[model samples]
Target: MAAAMTRMLQLLLITTLIHVARGKVRVQITNMIGYKDDMNITCQSSDDDLGQHVLSYGQSMEWKFKPNFSKTTLFHCNARWCDVMRRIDFGAYEYMKDHYGCGSDCRWMFTIDGVYAYDSKTDSWDFRFSWYS
Candidate 1:
């Protein structure tokens, strides 16, 4: 009976973990610029604010998002340098899942000129960026 109880507990834990994992998405943003100037970063989707931060040279920030009822969600990050703003957008689930599985976390690196999304499987970056002054 004790052995059976232990197996049941393990199964329960696995199920709970899978449920929790499905509810959220994790992502990281890194600053690859050489300058010390701080960059203001903001992330939003479907008018919902995910987070905001300021990153200095070689700094990185990680954030998590819980998607709403929409499978087609738009996630965007904006980085400001002086008067210029560089914005990068991801289809959130579509892009992240294509590269990093929904159960896995993803990362992105930002440079002064562009942005790159990290692929953990290949250990490489896929450039994705847009600039606006």
Candidate 2:
């Protein structure tokens, strides 16, 4: 009985530790990856994943992409992180009509791998589509 109790306590502690290890990350909408690139929307920490997630945006000081249509930063998390997790970017994102046609509003969709914690409401890009905060 004591052993089972100890195991339960251990599991709880480990879970708490994972959350504790997290840092405050702000997610913003833009065209570029990091801070400021060519086309950018804005930066802030809000409720859900940035847009409808039409575009999967993530910036690591390490990886880089080209042509620079628009770079956007989604969020900052632990060294090990992923957005649109189980949902594969190439695998799942392809099925949905991720890209929304644009003339001037540069609106798109994207994904985040994990749960995001925020108090504000998610941004609704359109009546039917919404962006993760």
Candidate 3:
């Protein structure tokens, strides 16, 4: 039966495409600083910075690709800067997200208080946190 043969082919095609692949991360991209763009959010797979992300906030969330900030420098972590970190600021927390989730599958988005633009080719967010501390 041609009809039966077609059904079998369709079933085979569906099964072939019904594959579940493992990924580097599984989380939502939060806009902590109101940055308007896709966030870079990183993943460390560690105890704390597990699914750590890198998001630039505000409309300025487009400065992450500047030739200046190639990496985020560790500026002493404090509980005070915890909630305040929500506010866009390039002073200290450069590329580090707020580290939202707790398990090895969570992370944070940045304020990108001083941003520039977003990258389309790749799902990466770029921006500058602030001009001053």
**TM-scores for every candidate against the unseen true structure:** 0.62, 0.22, 0.22
Error of 3 at 13 (Å): 6.2
Taken over the whole model, the C-alpha lDDT of each candidate is 0.66, 0.28, 0.34
Clashes (candidate 1): 0
Please give, for residues 72-106, the per-residue lDDT of candidate 1 as tens digits.
Answer: 54576667655454455445334444323534476
Sorted by TM-score, highest first, which candidate order results?
1, 2, 3
The best-first sequence of candidates by lDDT reads 1, 3, 2
Off by over 4 Å in 2: 27-120, 124-133
lDDT of 3 by residue, 1-133 (tens): 9999999999986764542122122233344544354344333211234333454443112111111122242222111123343333222222254222121132224443543323334445655334235
Instruction: Tell me the tens digit of each residue's lDDT in model 2 across 78-110.
Output: 211133322312111110122222211222223
TM-score of 2: 0.22
